[model samples]
Target: MTLSSMSETGTCTDIINLRYQDGSVGSPSKPQKFNYQDFGQLKQTYLRKGRLFVDSTFPPDYKSLGNLSDLPRSVRSRVEWLRPSDILKAQNVKGEPSFFVESASRFDFAQGKVGNCWFLAAIASLTFQKDLMVQVVPTEQDFEDYAGIFHFRFWRFGKWVDVVIDDYLPTFQRELLSVSAKTRNEFWVPLLEKAYAKVCGSYSDMNAGLPSEAFKDFSGGVHMTYKLKEVHDRNHDEVLWGQLTRATKCKSMICSGTAQKGDTIVNTVADSGIVDAHAYSITAVAEVHDGSSNVRLVRVMNPWGEKEWNGKWSDESSWWNRVSSEDKAKCVKRDDGEFWMELEDFCQHFQILTICCENPNFIDGDVITQWKVMIYDGEWVAGRTAGGSLSNSTFSTNPQFRITVTEIDTEEKEDKNVLLSLMQIPSQRYRNDERLRPIGITVFETPAGRIENSFFRRNSPMKRIQLYGYERDLIEQHSLKPGEYVVVPSIMKAYAPGKFVLSVYTKTETSIEPHHEGEDDDDDEDHLILPTPPKPVVPAEKSSVYDIFKSYADQNGELSAWQLRKLLNETIAKGSSDLFDWSACRTMISVVDADRMGRMTFKEFSTLWSKFEDFKKIFNRSNVSKTGTLTYDELKSAVQAADIELDDNMVWLQYSLLQGDSSISLVDFLTLMLRMDNMAKKFKDKSSDGFITMDWNEFAADFMFI
Candidate 1:
């Protein structure tokens, strides 16, 4: 069946007349233009030569830096890589190089050694839907055409990217190590898995993930996660039944996960023959007519292809006898691990349901009436913009976008759905302890044309902020009226840098323009201007370091990293290298940071700074270079200048540990100097042998961790 016969997707309309009327959507970064060759051109190139497509974006020839041992000890794990020829036999049951013996099925994707059942379940669900598999794993590739090359496309960030891969796959003793199809000869399953693994950087990266993510990536669609309890609270069991049926009709992929007890993962089968903490694909949701009346039945397939719910409506259950033989045949697919269960039983068995809505405008032949999606790449620079939630502050300084929705989709019963997805850029691909920061987007229905600071005014109401309670690549869909809206994507922490892709999908004609903050040249200064007089400086008595910190930081509830440096510059010695040390201050902040939230509360800042204040003075007095930082030799000199002494080996070890330039900031200098002083002072006691117990507060105060 063709794509049009399978489902109806939205179309894109003409660009409306909406230009940047005011400030930027988020940060001040210039809008990035993606200029890769279109799929049409790439396809033509491949067909002309019968040569495989090799994605230039993420080249297949690239090799990964082995399981990153450099990652934080908390997250480190090993990964093994092998080739496909090392695993598969030369022929299958039919005695041919396994490309495909027959059409792919839900049974084709059985879970293997990898713990990516969520991903496998999504692939299985796609097999039942005609065009989804073709869209993801391009049919243009086959074993006969394979000159050791294959390519597949996936929806990533805000666009579909073609990922190329070789037939080589990880294996052990001629068995596929990761995902494998039931038939040893079938190459499409492993080829698809290999292509997907390349898109994620490594096979190891797909070890654990959500099926909703896989569905969204497989189809350039919007994903929504729903809790079973919330669905029940909203209405009756029939409500979810209608939803599942509609999803199946529209070819929207759906998957469910069973809840397990406690934090421990349980893989053993339950009494019902269903495995807890496992993902299962929703193959079909049908309202079959029984001899007495119509009954709602949902067919679910386990990726394991063995365990299944043996409750009512199961393969051998009495409920099948009540239904017509034709209906019974449709419900029971015994050995495939697919079984029918009543809609009510499904709700009881599954804890989470995730659905992916294919892009409404994603049609094959038509362009108009389809959903037009706009994707913007943005970064949250710590000192510049990456601020917390807008409810706590204004997102006027963050990246901002002006989206004008001209018309809503009139074809569907529901109003136009605006989907906004924020995805953080992937990082630390090889490292086990990859760091992640919470990120979210806030959309405000502003006056058609407004400036940046307008939203920051006192008590200005916000339309929608923090739509999803938590961050981590949030997706929020709203049925909104056709109009102009301003959106700002931000990291949840103040001054924490993060990169993200903001995807906007609307079932209408929408124009997304970056809001740039600039004064119109038309506003001329023809009138004579008067010279402004210099403001008089206020002279006041000096206060202690703690008192000075409270003065500058009281304006905002938290003290920023930059603010800390300014405080040190004013309260301590001026023109010292320590005063301008950004990296050192950041490092120092991490050390004193209690929650690792990056931003510091006033009390936390005061406690950390009070101990280093004396050392700042000592470092400042010895600042001959005045660069706001000192080299190892300069730091050593300053330490000796302060009459503190340490063994050469000890001094060298401390300096070597300093990151970046192997230099010391005011914070580091103060920390090192104080530690040496504490050691010397304690050594005066004959019984003291370099052992002293320091609380968290004392540790921050006494150490200059260069």
Candidate 2:
């Protein structure tokens, strides 16, 4: 059969406007550009359950540092806290949570599965000073807890801050979430105040999620301040940083932390500093996870800064062992915070903070010795760990997520072996709702950048931000930190295969850490990268060469030589990347046959051109560098010293010769190729089988002078 008997894609209007054959201008259907920010304002007419899901692995316990050989397995196994270093390491790799952080000092004790606020509080205090994280204990050996703490005094608007603690978190009687978490979520009173020193704004304002709010709208806000991020060697680039605080006087920003089951250290840095999206403090010596007894350990903060080791003690391993000999407990591996990777999977799994504190300001007497943990509130990008299955908001009706928790048995000798205690088995789609969920992996790439958030449900808002467009329906406010970004639809769709106007908006600001009260302002501005350049405007690509020919054929109700040449030349000059791209263009053509059966329409030219504009743009006169058209010599000459001999015109001719009735586009292009293959040869060798493929009107096509 001829090429006209294939499937139908979209309907065509005229030479300028093309829509789906069904009359509606088709939208750019797949390879979507999702507006996570104003999703609420978007037209909710979704092809329900049509998207795939995303998932990843969490940090592993076996990869944790330190040993717990002396402690019981139950306590060691059940005890777990989120580490700042690990979170920062993960962010560095996957580059997720792209929201830029303030250069201010910050801290937060991550409540693991057990929700031990007490332990998180103790760790929070340790973040105040490098030694505090070290002095605090994680083991039950000498004074009970073996975890240390660090502190760094934060100055926001003004006034000194104080927050101290060493206790366990309260648990829910019936449940520990949502309504169950109202008390813990509430600000001040018994829970927030008793443990905290003095909340930032006042005892009444801890709920504002300071540093966050302060940075959002305070005198020395996050926008102008400067920070020093030297977690690595090359920490000196002026362009990377955001501007310094426009406000003259700097205020202190501090977080409060409760205590842990057993931790030491009186004071540390007053408040840990922020780096990228993380906060950190120094620890005296650390005892990570070990299958045996609770190992004495030091805690460290991720100020988005470096792991600092001053070498106070001569023998590195004398005071505390970086690596434990007795403890065989499973340790949580440090890796990228945003993406998931198996803990035991080589170097990608775990990472230790490298010490790099050389600033004279970071002296023994200057370090903030006491700190409290704080949690900022805003548009949070939420994700879950690897799941065998996934359900909706609840897990009772249909357990969509089936996770396996490995209980570290430190009491027994067998637990010390690097064996997985419990592994969650991957569950096939069973529940009806589970199948509709965005559960597997859905990577959204737009003009702004890339958003790789994993959605649990079909319509769950994994990405929440300000609203836009369409009156009340449009979510207008955007919660973007300086250096953060967003995607917006630019133009109204006309020839657009789809109906949407999206544009990318990147914040034109930097992220710099604030300065100490007594410290001088003379310092190098590093870490904060300048805002990305504004996006360039791109024109919508017209139809392809073949599609144009097809359109002319259908309009005139017959195929003519002139129509064929025009289509062929158009395809070569505009649609394809040179005449040769006709083969590639044909490959594009081969996909859409246009009819009900296996046939193609003259309009495939338009369809193909619109789809592959970026690729086609490479062949334009602009890239060719010639004034109006590509000259014959320019075509034959090396397109650069790269690739092979030129065949721009031949490619154009071969595309016209392609018979819609029989054979493939490739075969047809090859036939023309075989006809003039030898044209490019320096001196035709009689014995050579290749034919010369040069243009007959070389002189006429040279100057582009019509």
Candidate 3:
């Protein structure tokens, strides 16, 4: 089949060859299916094209610009607009193709829902290759008038590509096409068919797909430089133009075009006195006159409707970069959409945040003398200057393209002033001491000099996570990437330094039940446990390696009767392992039994002397020595073997032995053990029916240090 558009007829394949540098001659991707409400939302936005109401007090996201004065003058004043050479250098710094645009933008689209920013961006690129916009026309095949048909072709890369479109821009009233039952298919059906028949000629027609998807069908010919090919069909969106400007690699800075359906109009950035500012757009400039005005003057309707400079060529503004401080006067404020400025100044300063949106009041009656005004973002290599300095610290200077700040909390102790540190964890490991690399936020408790758990930024921000106050359910914890963080909760909790657990969620109580053997775990195969391993029976007698040590201790110091019994068990089960190996002590068999006390806790265990064993070797070997008790020197040597760091436990143990160097005598040791046994039994108090006491092994674990 053959198709013709703009005086060119060709096969489907022939049309595919029309690709341009930044324009795609290709068909776009198919649009995703929109539900009724989603589609309605889009339509409603178009209907509500009212003037902007910028609220400067709010954050950037919520603020609307009052006028040029309310714009981010700080940014605009400091960062000089990039020269063509600068743009070219910044071009593809990240290795991506960029159409340098600081040289072209004339007008910007204000905050509107129109997706025309992209169209404007494309227009910017088009100017580089010469009259690209006027080259395309919509015609029909096997028919005339081209009423419902469109044979549109645009130059992309270096070629012209044809696309047949049938779908009318979606309208507000679906009922517009619902002309009763009699004319049901008459209006919309003919409109759609005629639209399609014209574009593709006798072949397939209608560009009914996602922007990216349509491009894919057109392939290399039409999408030579548009690079819509890189964006996935599913993620392609009409709002992509704004995001593109922010994206470093999409470096095409300048853009211009008429507003369309899906564009967003924002307040003026030019007014903000900041480059890359936001503003509103009112109407389009169809034609113009010449004389005193060097550049054309397009009439634009401001959202604030505040009349700044309303005249041809905007004699009030510093247009052509030629307005002297003395010549230019302050702008007057008004409350209507009517505002006039030179074409270049109007376009270069404010960027239309969105693509073109429909001007609900555009006059077809009398060609109103107006400009298809645009609001575009300004260029900035550094943050806007406030006084003589940049706003966000020294200029980034391209050290890195992205910067993220995070706050970390430190544990609180029950005593001094404490501070919190916010550090950016580098992906790779290296010592970072640069003051700029990290900063401190000293946390102060409410109503006083007290402190609390470390917060993201220790300082009190205007809007914070809201904890320890009326809104204290503080469940919105952040999931930080794994790395080192810093915090000093309060003087009491001084500094928080440790590897914290990765938490999934926080609740008042866990409430989940522990798994019990033989229980069917909801029929999920997880209930299947491996066969129970037989319990090992350690020998009751026959002194092992530990007995030898016990004998030495006996000769050295009297072994308490309880210690003797532990010696027997240690000899049989553990051989000569140090009694204080972290793992062994933690296993519930080390301390209490050796101390002859069936109960133990960190405080109680503090009084006892301990011997250490190589913690690492303790696990490598089997039973025996798994829970042997050692004396002062022996303990020190054993701990060294384990590669364990000496902690408070080791010191306390040594202190006990030095305090009493009495050698063990069987009789005296037996008496001490007997008393310990009685004390253990009494403390357990078996009389409390359901309340159970932990066994000897558990007692030992109560004081185990990991």
Candidate 4:
């Protein structure tokens, strides 16, 4: 499968084109289906059956309310589930209820009891851009053909998924409990909110989040965040202003949040009329001449549809007197929750500013500059591909994507040509239950070939973005010379299962593809060759080890592992420092136990004795330091010397599993070799067409023994 596709316009057109059957791209082996509930099919079926549709997937119940502990006692006690028709009718004296009163606007909705102003702020900002608005809330549906079902599309990871929800909404005292519309007959706000809540697993899961997080789910675009505290510097303020102005001109979605006061409760209203720890949308940004100088002003909207900023340049402020009639008229003041604030006060009050757009040219301050975007979906499967961080020996086993930068932007001195975004996909049915894994990305300048563990051992990463916390996404911008590079995404903890999407945005043309070991080369030539087994050590002519083995054997002439261990320590390992342990001796017996018995007969003992002698000589030779333990490389060489076949990845994995303190003892090495032999033999006997399928019991039995 292709790793990514490029687009010059920086739009989602390339992604749209890449989409296959259901607007999904990437590996077809396991494509993600959109809106598992088929709206059209369900609508027709329900209509034919003379019934209204009800979504069983996201039902109207306490489960949909999420964790009961998060709900207030008052809300939980009075909560009543109601459909839109019931909600509108209970309010009394309303015309036929409609999904939307008219064209949706920022004033259409007001935040309810949920502490999700961040989400409401993004929804308010979305209203300003109708094109983006329609992408999320399709304009095709209405009350005219109501089936009690509504679907909304959201950009999830790298694909758009349609989330369907029934019209049932939670209400308290006959009023919608979440987001409610200003017009009583309009039900779009609450319905849309329900759909989004379903995507988040439940309404409670939507509590307390960054606007940028919702903004990404809304547009799946390039998101840039600015820390307002950092903008206190004059130079940084100017840069931020330039970017915000350009972003506004480009019609990008923007939102900001107020910093929390010391131990202050969230949404606590201050005397200044601005809520503490609340989110707001930037509806507009302008610079007006106040007869003296240009005054930079920003229009901010509170999702509550009330409680607006009452400081200077506010709706009732006398600051409008200084500006000309034209500018004053353009900046109309009202009590609709939207008011103007001076740029200085805006920076002083807000802690974070976020902007998102399909095209990120606004970040460069040059809207004409277009970028090429590429996206890829990948997963980290435990044991096989979840190879943890760079410090891990199996890091190379993680998925790797190779990208070649063919050109660079020459307009700037040090252009950040590449932008990497790694987003982890949630694996739980409920967001509250999902524990996000700490994920990161590493980039390395390398030759145009598949990288292996050896390469990672010999080289260091050119760039690393380490997020040790449980962040859903990690993004970084890098400036590098034109060359081939490999990007590796991994979880901080080894062998943790998860999925992710990696998006690459470059200023110029680039090519990317997933790299697999030996995919581009001859497998036979790259395979490691095993050396000839060393000759067995001879016993003293008169003594003869066979005669000694009979003494340790029982009446049946069979030697158990305990007996074999005694024999070895007394003879072969008598003067040698290295000695066989009970576990190693047991594994050795298991390896050659053809009768499935725990003991070895004389014939079996003879065969194992010769191999054991050869292995001991090879191990001693490979352990040049005579440390009584072998490093990863030394152990690998010893295994090869004993004529055990294994590829580089397998050898690395085995060593990682068996090594302690970066090395393995002779006993551990012997056990490892024996287990590998048993596993290989089992696969050869059980596998069909190179794939083995075993039930849980069989798998558990084999795993325990192996």
Best by TM-score: 4
Ten contiguous residues with the weakest lDDT in model 3:
1-10
Q: Count the backbone clashes (under 3 Å) in each candidate.
A: 30, 182, 130, 0
- lDDT, candidate 2, 1-706, per-residue tens: 0011001111211111111122221111111111111111121212133321110010123222113233355545554332222333433433322111321012321322222222222233323333222222211112111121111122111111222221122222222110111122211112222223122211211221212222221111112112223311244322211011101101212221212122532223322111122222222222233344433322233321232222221122232243344422222223211111111110111122211111111111122222111111001001111111223222111111111112323443432111000101111111111111111211111212122223223333213432222210011112222222212121111111111111111111211111111233232222111212112122344333543443445211223334434455564444543343444333333343221111233454344444345323323422355433333343333232223354677533444455344322322332233223323323254225665443433222221211
C-alpha RMSD by candidate, in order: 14.4, 29.2, 30.7, 18.4
Give the alpha carbon lDDT tens digit for every residue of 1-706 in model 4: 0111111122222222122343332222222224345566777787788777887757888778776455678778778889888887888846777877778888999998887899999998888677778878978888777778887777877766666778899988898888988888888878888988887778888888889988888878778888887885555867877777777766588999998878844678989899999999988777887777888888889999999888988988888888877667755567788988888898888888998877666777655445666677677755567778988887877888887887776778767778888898765445566678889888999996678889998988876444455777787777767899988888997666677888877764666566545555665222211111112243565246668776676423467777789887888668756678787787777677543345676667777766666666777889988887798889878878866678889889988987878887766765676677677778887899988998654464455434
Q: lDDT for every model?
A: 0.60, 0.23, 0.25, 0.74
The positional error of residue 435 in candidate 3, measured at the CA in angstroms, is 33
Model 1 global lDDT (CA atoms, 0 to 1): 0.60
Which portions of model 2 miss their true places by more than 4 Å? 1-37, 42-296, 300-535, 538-706
Off by over 4 Å in 1: 1-94, 360-370, 391-394, 405-417, 430-436, 448-450, 457-472, 479-483, 520-706
Against the correct fold, how does model 2 do in TM-score? 0.18
Error of 3 at 58 (Å): 40
lDDT of 1 by residue, 105-131 (tens): 778757766566888889887876666
Q: Candidate 3 overall Cα lDDT vs. reference? A: 0.25
Worst 10 residues of 4 by lDDT: 1-10
- Could you tell me the lDDT of residue 507 within candidate 3? 15
TM-score, per-candidate, Cα-based: 0.63, 0.18, 0.19, 0.70
The lDDT-based order of candidates, best leading, equals 4, 1, 3, 2
Task: State which candidate, 1 or 4, has the greater lDDT.
Answer: 4
